[model samples]
Target: MHEFSLVKSLLRQVNEIAEQHGATCVEEVKIEIGPLTGVEKILVQEAFELLSPDLPGSDCRLTIIEVPLQAICNSCGKSIVVQNFQFQCTACGSSNIRITSGDAFRLLDVTIDTELTTGVTEP
Candidate 1:
Protein backbone atom coordinates (compact mmCIF):
# COMPACT_ATOMS: atom_id res chain seq x y z
CA MET A 1 0.00 0.00 0.00
CA HIS A 2 1.03 3.60 -0.51
CA GLU A 3 0.74 4.03 3.21
CA PHE A 4 3.97 2.14 3.63
CA SER A 5 5.83 4.61 1.46
CA LEU A 6 4.19 7.51 3.23
CA VAL A 7 5.14 6.12 6.60
CA LYS A 8 8.67 5.52 5.44
CA SER A 9 8.97 9.11 4.36
CA LEU A 10 7.51 10.24 7.65
CA LEU A 11 10.05 8.23 9.61
CA ARG A 12 12.88 9.66 7.61
CA GLN A 13 11.66 13.16 8.27
CA VAL A 14 11.32 12.45 11.96
CA ASN A 15 14.77 11.03 12.09
CA GLU A 16 16.16 14.12 10.44
CA ILE A 17 14.42 16.29 12.96
CA ALA A 18 15.79 14.24 15.81
CA GLU A 19 19.30 14.49 14.45
CA GLN A 20 18.93 18.23 14.02
CA HIS A 21 18.03 18.56 17.65
CA GLY A 22 20.78 16.17 18.80
CA ALA A 23 18.11 13.99 20.30
CA THR A 24 19.06 10.82 22.12
CA CYS A 25 15.74 9.28 21.08
CA VAL A 26 12.60 10.16 19.34
CA GLU A 27 9.66 10.27 21.72
CA GLU A 28 6.62 11.02 19.62
CA VAL A 29 5.62 12.04 16.15
CA LYS A 30 2.34 13.85 15.65
CA ILE A 31 0.54 14.09 12.36
CA GLU A 32 -2.74 15.40 11.08
CA ILE A 33 -4.83 13.60 8.50
CA GLY A 34 -7.92 14.73 6.70
CA PRO A 35 -10.77 12.78 5.17
CA LEU A 36 -9.56 13.64 1.68
CA THR A 37 -5.91 12.79 2.31
CA GLY A 38 -6.46 9.45 0.50
CA VAL A 39 -4.46 7.52 3.09
CA GLU A 40 -5.86 4.92 5.44
CA LYS A 41 -5.23 5.51 9.12
CA ILE A 42 -5.02 1.84 9.97
CA LEU A 43 -2.63 1.18 7.15
CA VAL A 44 -0.45 4.07 8.20
CA GLN A 45 -0.33 2.76 11.73
CA GLU A 46 0.59 -0.69 10.50
CA ALA A 47 3.30 0.67 8.31
CA PHE A 48 4.71 2.68 11.16
CA GLU A 49 4.77 -0.37 13.37
CA LEU A 50 6.63 -2.26 10.70
CA LEU A 51 9.17 0.41 9.84
CA SER A 52 9.74 2.55 12.91
CA PRO A 53 11.94 -0.03 14.59
CA ASP A 54 14.57 0.50 11.92
CA LEU A 55 15.06 4.02 13.18
CA PRO A 56 17.14 5.00 16.21
CA GLY A 57 14.15 5.16 18.49
CA SER A 58 12.10 2.03 18.04
CA ASP A 59 9.79 3.06 20.86
CA CYS A 60 8.68 6.27 19.24
CA ARG A 61 4.95 6.73 19.43
CA LEU A 62 2.87 7.90 16.51
CA THR A 63 -0.03 10.22 17.18
CA ILE A 64 -2.57 10.67 14.44
CA ILE A 65 -5.05 13.49 14.71
CA GLU A 66 -8.17 13.42 12.59
CA VAL A 67 -9.13 16.81 11.30
CA PRO A 68 -12.50 17.79 9.91
CA LEU A 69 -12.94 19.08 6.40
CA GLN A 70 -13.40 22.80 6.65
CA ALA A 71 -14.11 25.50 4.14
CA ILE A 72 -14.97 29.14 3.79
CA CYS A 73 -17.80 30.41 1.68
CA ASN A 74 -16.72 33.05 -0.75
CA SER A 75 -20.22 34.36 -1.18
CA CYS A 76 -21.16 34.80 2.45
CA GLY A 77 -17.76 34.91 4.15
CA LYS A 78 -18.89 32.14 6.48
CA SER A 79 -16.74 29.36 7.84
CA ILE A 80 -18.10 25.85 7.68
CA VAL A 81 -17.15 22.36 8.61
CA VAL A 82 -18.06 20.19 5.68
CA GLN A 83 -20.06 17.05 6.29
CA ASN A 84 -20.45 13.98 4.06
CA PHE A 85 -18.07 15.51 1.52
CA GLN A 86 -20.57 18.16 0.58
CA PHE A 87 -18.88 21.08 -1.19
CA GLN A 88 -21.72 23.50 -0.76
CA CYS A 89 -21.52 26.12 1.94
CA THR A 90 -23.91 25.69 4.84
CA ALA A 91 -24.45 29.31 5.75
CA CYS A 92 -25.46 30.57 2.31
CA GLY A 93 -25.73 27.37 0.31
CA SER A 94 -23.04 28.62 -2.01
CA SER A 95 -21.00 26.32 -4.19
CA ASN A 96 -18.22 28.86 -4.35
CA ILE A 97 -16.37 27.73 -1.31
CA ARG A 98 -12.64 27.65 -0.67
CA ILE A 99 -11.26 24.70 1.17
CA THR A 100 -9.37 25.79 4.26
CA SER A 101 -8.34 22.46 5.70
CA GLY A 102 -8.71 18.67 5.60
CA ASP A 103 -7.19 18.20 2.20
CA ALA A 104 -3.80 16.71 3.01
CA PHE A 105 -1.74 14.71 5.42
CA ARG A 106 0.59 16.97 7.38
CA LEU A 107 3.30 16.52 9.94
CA LEU A 108 2.37 18.60 12.97
CA ASP A 109 5.25 18.20 15.43
CA VAL A 110 7.82 15.79 16.77
CA THR A 111 8.88 15.25 20.35
CA ILE A 112 12.39 14.06 20.99
CA ASP A 113 14.37 13.19 24.07
CA THR A 114 17.68 14.93 24.55
CA GLU A 115 20.42 14.05 26.95
CA LEU A 116 21.72 16.70 29.25
CA THR A 117 25.40 16.94 30.21
CA THR A 118 24.36 15.85 33.71
CA GLY A 119 23.48 12.37 32.40
CA VAL A 120 19.73 12.93 32.40
CA THR A 121 17.17 12.82 29.61
CA GLU A 122 14.77 15.63 28.88
CA PRO A 123 12.18 16.24 26.21
Candidate 2:
Protein backbone atom coordinates (compact mmCIF):
# COMPACT_ATOMS: atom_id res chain seq x y z
CA MET A 1 0.00 0.00 0.00
CA HIS A 2 1.02 3.62 -0.59
CA GLU A 3 0.43 4.23 3.08
CA PHE A 4 3.53 2.25 3.86
CA SER A 5 5.71 4.61 1.88
CA LEU A 6 4.00 7.64 3.29
CA VAL A 7 4.44 6.43 6.86
CA LYS A 8 8.05 5.65 6.11
CA SER A 9 8.69 9.21 5.03
CA LEU A 10 6.81 10.57 8.01
CA LEU A 11 8.79 8.49 10.45
CA ARG A 12 12.00 9.56 8.82
CA GLN A 13 11.15 13.17 9.37
CA VAL A 14 10.18 12.42 12.95
CA ASN A 15 13.48 10.72 13.51
CA GLU A 16 15.33 13.74 12.23
CA ILE A 17 13.40 16.02 14.50
CA ALA A 18 13.93 13.81 17.52
CA GLU A 19 17.62 13.56 16.85
CA GLN A 20 17.90 17.31 16.47
CA HIS A 21 16.51 17.72 19.94
CA GLY A 22 18.40 14.77 21.45
CA ALA A 23 15.16 13.07 22.31
CA THR A 24 15.09 9.72 24.03
CA CYS A 25 11.66 8.76 22.85
CA VAL A 26 8.90 10.23 20.80
CA GLU A 27 5.65 10.76 22.63
CA GLU A 28 3.24 11.62 19.88
CA VAL A 29 3.02 12.73 16.28
CA LYS A 30 0.17 14.82 14.88
CA ILE A 31 -0.55 14.99 11.18
CA GLU A 32 -3.20 16.35 8.88
CA ILE A 33 -4.43 14.24 5.98
CA GLY A 34 -6.90 15.56 3.48
CA PRO A 35 -9.51 13.52 1.70
CA LEU A 36 -7.94 14.14 -1.68
CA THR A 37 -4.47 13.18 -0.46
CA GLY A 38 -5.16 9.59 -1.65
CA VAL A 39 -3.76 8.19 1.56
CA GLU A 40 -6.01 5.99 3.66
CA LYS A 41 -6.03 6.78 7.38
CA ILE A 42 -6.53 3.21 8.54
CA LEU A 43 -3.68 1.91 6.46
CA VAL A 44 -1.35 4.70 7.53
CA GLN A 45 -2.14 4.08 11.17
CA GLU A 46 -1.59 0.39 10.78
CA ALA A 47 1.72 0.98 9.10
CA PHE A 48 2.79 3.40 11.77
CA GLU A 49 1.92 0.93 14.50
CA LEU A 50 3.66 -1.88 12.71
CA LEU A 51 6.80 0.13 12.07
CA SER A 52 7.05 2.19 15.25
CA PRO A 53 9.08 -0.31 17.22
CA ASP A 54 11.83 -0.60 14.64
CA LEU A 55 12.21 3.14 14.20
CA PRO A 56 14.05 5.65 16.31
CA GLY A 57 10.90 6.85 17.98
CA SER A 58 9.66 3.70 19.59
CA ASP A 59 6.22 3.52 21.24
CA CYS A 60 5.12 6.67 19.51
CA ARG A 61 1.45 7.25 18.65
CA LEU A 62 0.24 8.83 15.46
CA THR A 63 -2.82 11.07 15.31
CA ILE A 64 -4.43 11.96 12.03
CA ILE A 65 -6.83 14.83 11.40
CA GLU A 66 -9.01 14.61 8.33
CA VAL A 67 -9.54 17.69 6.21
CA PRO A 68 -12.50 18.21 3.91
CA LEU A 69 -11.98 18.84 0.24
CA GLN A 70 -13.09 22.22 -1.07
CA ALA A 71 -13.35 23.59 -4.58
CA ILE A 72 -14.47 26.69 -6.36
CA CYS A 73 -16.83 26.32 -9.29
CA ASN A 74 -15.54 28.01 -12.39
CA SER A 75 -18.89 28.32 -14.11
CA CYS A 76 -21.11 29.35 -11.20
CA GLY A 77 -18.54 31.06 -8.96
CA LYS A 78 -19.68 28.94 -6.08
CA SER A 79 -17.68 27.44 -3.28
CA ILE A 80 -18.34 23.76 -2.98
CA VAL A 81 -17.36 21.27 -0.31
CA VAL A 82 -16.77 18.15 -2.31
CA GLN A 83 -18.16 14.96 -0.85
CA ASN A 84 -18.16 11.37 -2.13
CA PHE A 85 -15.70 12.25 -4.87
CA GLN A 86 -18.14 14.55 -6.59
CA PHE A 87 -16.38 17.35 -8.43
CA GLN A 88 -19.54 18.91 -9.80
CA CYS A 89 -20.59 22.27 -8.53
CA THR A 90 -23.51 22.35 -6.13
CA ALA A 91 -24.90 25.63 -7.42
CA CYS A 92 -25.05 25.29 -11.22
CA GLY A 93 -24.08 21.65 -11.74
CA SER A 94 -20.88 22.74 -13.38
CA SER A 95 -18.04 20.32 -13.87
CA ASN A 96 -15.45 23.07 -14.28
CA ILE A 97 -13.90 23.57 -10.87
CA ARG A 98 -10.63 24.44 -9.18
CA ILE A 99 -9.62 22.57 -6.07
CA THR A 100 -8.50 24.76 -3.19
CA SER A 101 -7.71 22.30 -0.41
CA GLY A 102 -8.08 18.67 0.70
CA ASP A 103 -4.91 17.54 -0.99
CA ALA A 104 -2.59 18.01 1.98
CA PHE A 105 -0.52 15.39 3.81
CA ARG A 106 1.61 17.21 6.34
CA LEU A 107 3.01 16.65 9.78
CA LEU A 108 1.77 19.33 12.16
CA ASP A 109 3.80 18.67 15.27
CA VAL A 110 5.86 16.14 17.20
CA THR A 111 6.16 15.70 20.92
CA ILE A 112 9.36 14.18 22.14
CA ASP A 113 10.95 13.31 25.44
CA THR A 114 14.42 14.74 25.39
CA GLU A 115 17.27 14.04 27.72
CA LEU A 116 18.08 16.81 30.17
CA THR A 117 21.39 17.12 31.89
CA THR A 118 21.68 18.40 35.41
CA GLY A 119 21.04 22.18 35.57
CA VAL A 120 21.21 22.63 31.83
CA THR A 121 20.93 26.25 30.84
CA GLU A 122 19.24 27.52 27.70
CA PRO A 123 20.40 30.52 25.77
Candidate 3:
Protein backbone atom coordinates (compact mmCIF):
# COMPACT_ATOMS: atom_id res chain seq x y z
CA MET A 1 0.00 0.00 0.00
CA HIS A 2 1.03 3.60 -0.54
CA GLU A 3 0.53 4.23 3.13
CA PHE A 4 3.37 1.86 3.94
CA SER A 5 5.73 3.79 1.71
CA LEU A 6 4.61 7.08 3.16
CA VAL A 7 5.13 5.85 6.70
CA LYS A 8 8.53 4.50 5.77
CA SER A 9 9.59 7.91 4.51
CA LEU A 10 8.28 9.58 7.63
CA LEU A 11 10.13 7.13 9.89
CA ARG A 12 13.30 7.70 7.95
CA GLN A 13 13.06 11.45 8.41
CA VAL A 14 12.27 11.06 12.09
CA ASN A 15 15.19 8.75 12.57
CA GLU A 16 17.46 11.20 10.87
CA ILE A 17 16.33 14.01 13.13
CA ALA A 18 16.54 11.82 16.21
CA GLU A 19 20.05 10.83 15.37
CA GLN A 20 21.08 14.44 14.89
CA HIS A 21 19.62 15.30 18.29
CA GLY A 22 21.00 12.19 19.96
CA ALA A 23 17.57 10.84 20.87
CA THR A 24 17.41 7.30 22.14
CA CYS A 25 13.74 6.74 21.35
CA VAL A 26 11.06 8.57 19.51
CA GLU A 27 8.02 9.30 21.60
CA GLU A 28 5.63 10.89 19.12
CA VAL A 29 5.38 11.92 15.52
CA LYS A 30 2.80 14.51 14.44
CA ILE A 31 1.61 14.54 10.87
CA GLU A 32 -0.72 16.78 8.93
CA ILE A 33 -2.90 15.12 6.30
CA GLY A 34 -5.23 17.05 4.09
CA PRO A 35 -8.68 15.78 3.22
CA LEU A 36 -7.95 15.94 -0.49
CA THR A 37 -4.65 14.10 -0.02
CA GLY A 38 -6.46 10.87 -1.07
CA VAL A 39 -4.98 8.91 1.81
CA GLU A 40 -6.99 6.92 4.32
CA LYS A 41 -6.15 7.65 7.95
CA ILE A 42 -6.76 4.16 9.20
CA LEU A 43 -4.53 2.66 6.56
CA VAL A 44 -1.67 5.03 7.38
CA GLN A 45 -1.99 4.33 11.08
CA GLU A 46 -2.03 0.60 10.52
CA ALA A 47 1.02 0.91 8.35
CA PHE A 48 2.79 2.98 10.96
CA GLU A 49 2.11 0.38 13.66
CA LEU A 50 3.27 -2.42 11.42
CA LEU A 51 6.42 -0.64 10.36
CA SER A 52 7.44 1.15 13.57
CA PRO A 53 9.36 -1.71 15.10
CA ASP A 54 11.47 -2.29 12.03
CA LEU A 55 12.62 1.34 12.06
CA PRO A 56 14.68 3.22 14.61
CA GLY A 57 11.68 4.91 16.18
CA SER A 58 10.12 1.76 17.55
CA ASP A 59 8.13 3.24 20.41
CA CYS A 60 6.94 6.29 18.56
CA ARG A 61 3.28 7.37 18.57
CA LEU A 62 1.60 8.60 15.41
CA THR A 63 -0.74 11.58 15.56
CA ILE A 64 -2.61 12.61 12.44
CA ILE A 65 -4.15 16.05 11.85
CA GLU A 66 -6.76 16.39 9.15
CA VAL A 67 -6.80 19.55 7.01
CA PRO A 68 -9.70 20.74 4.88
CA LEU A 69 -9.63 21.39 1.14
CA GLN A 70 -9.39 25.04 0.23
CA ALA A 71 -9.18 26.12 -3.37
CA ILE A 72 -8.86 29.48 -5.09
CA CYS A 73 -10.75 30.21 -8.26
CA ASN A 74 -8.58 31.21 -11.14
CA SER A 75 -11.35 33.20 -12.78
CA CYS A 76 -12.65 35.13 -9.76
CA GLY A 77 -9.72 34.68 -7.36
CA LYS A 78 -11.84 33.72 -4.39
CA SER A 79 -11.91 30.81 -2.00
CA ILE A 80 -13.98 27.86 -3.11
CA VAL A 81 -16.12 26.29 -0.49
CA VAL A 82 -16.37 22.52 -0.23
CA GLN A 83 -19.65 21.00 0.83
CA ASN A 84 -20.10 17.25 0.35
CA PHE A 85 -16.97 17.12 -1.84
CA GLN A 86 -18.34 19.73 -4.20
CA PHE A 87 -15.51 22.15 -5.03
CA GLN A 88 -16.72 25.36 -6.62
CA CYS A 89 -16.09 29.05 -6.30
CA THR A 90 -18.80 30.91 -4.44
CA ALA A 91 -18.24 34.21 -6.14
CA CYS A 92 -18.17 33.03 -9.72
CA GLY A 93 -19.17 30.08 -11.85
CA SER A 94 -15.72 29.05 -12.90
CA SER A 95 -14.34 25.58 -13.37
CA ASN A 96 -10.80 26.94 -13.61
CA ILE A 97 -9.67 26.75 -10.01
CA ARG A 98 -6.34 26.24 -8.30
CA ILE A 99 -6.17 24.14 -5.19
CA THR A 100 -4.54 26.02 -2.34
CA SER A 101 -4.51 23.40 0.41
CA GLY A 102 -5.99 20.15 1.72
CA ASP A 103 -3.77 17.94 -0.39
CA ALA A 104 -0.73 17.60 1.87
CA PHE A 105 0.71 14.67 3.76
CA ARG A 106 3.71 15.77 5.80
CA LEU A 107 5.42 15.22 9.09
CA LEU A 108 4.94 18.24 11.34
CA ASP A 109 7.21 17.39 14.24
CA VAL A 110 8.95 14.61 16.14
CA THR A 111 9.32 14.23 19.88
CA ILE A 112 12.11 12.14 21.27
CA ASP A 113 13.63 10.97 24.53
CA THR A 114 17.21 10.02 25.19
CA GLU A 115 19.83 9.54 27.85
CA LEU A 116 22.13 12.39 28.67
CA THR A 117 25.44 10.61 28.20
CA THR A 118 25.07 7.88 25.56
CA GLY A 119 23.82 8.35 22.02
CA VAL A 120 21.43 6.04 20.25
CA THR A 121 23.25 3.76 17.88
CA GLU A 122 21.66 3.26 14.51
CA PRO A 123 20.24 -0.18 13.90
Against the reference, the lDDT scores of all candidates come to: 0.89, 0.88, 0.82
Report the number of the highest-TM-score candidate: 1
* lDDT string, candidate 3, 3-114, tens digits: 8888888888888898898888888999998878888999999999987885454667889998778788999888875656677776787778887777888789988887
In candidate 1, what are the lDDT values of residues 38-96, reduced to their tens digit? 89999999999889887675688999999999999999999999999989999889999
Predict model 1's lDDT versus the native.
0.89
Q: What local lDDT score does residue 9 receive in model 3, on the 0 to 100 scale?
A: 88
What TM-score does structure 1 among the candidates reach? 0.91
Model 3 stretches with alpha carbons more than 4 Å out? 55-58, 117-123
- TM-score to true structure, per model: 0.91, 0.80, 0.81
> What is the lDDT, from 0 to 100, of the residue 13 in candidate 2?
91
Ranked by TM-score, top first: 1, 3, 2
Query: Which of the numbered candidates is closest to the native, going by highest lDDT?
Result: 1
- Candidate 2 structure lDDT: 0.88
Error of 1 at 32 (Å): 0.4
In model 1, where is the ten-residue run with the lowest total lDDT? Answer: 114-123
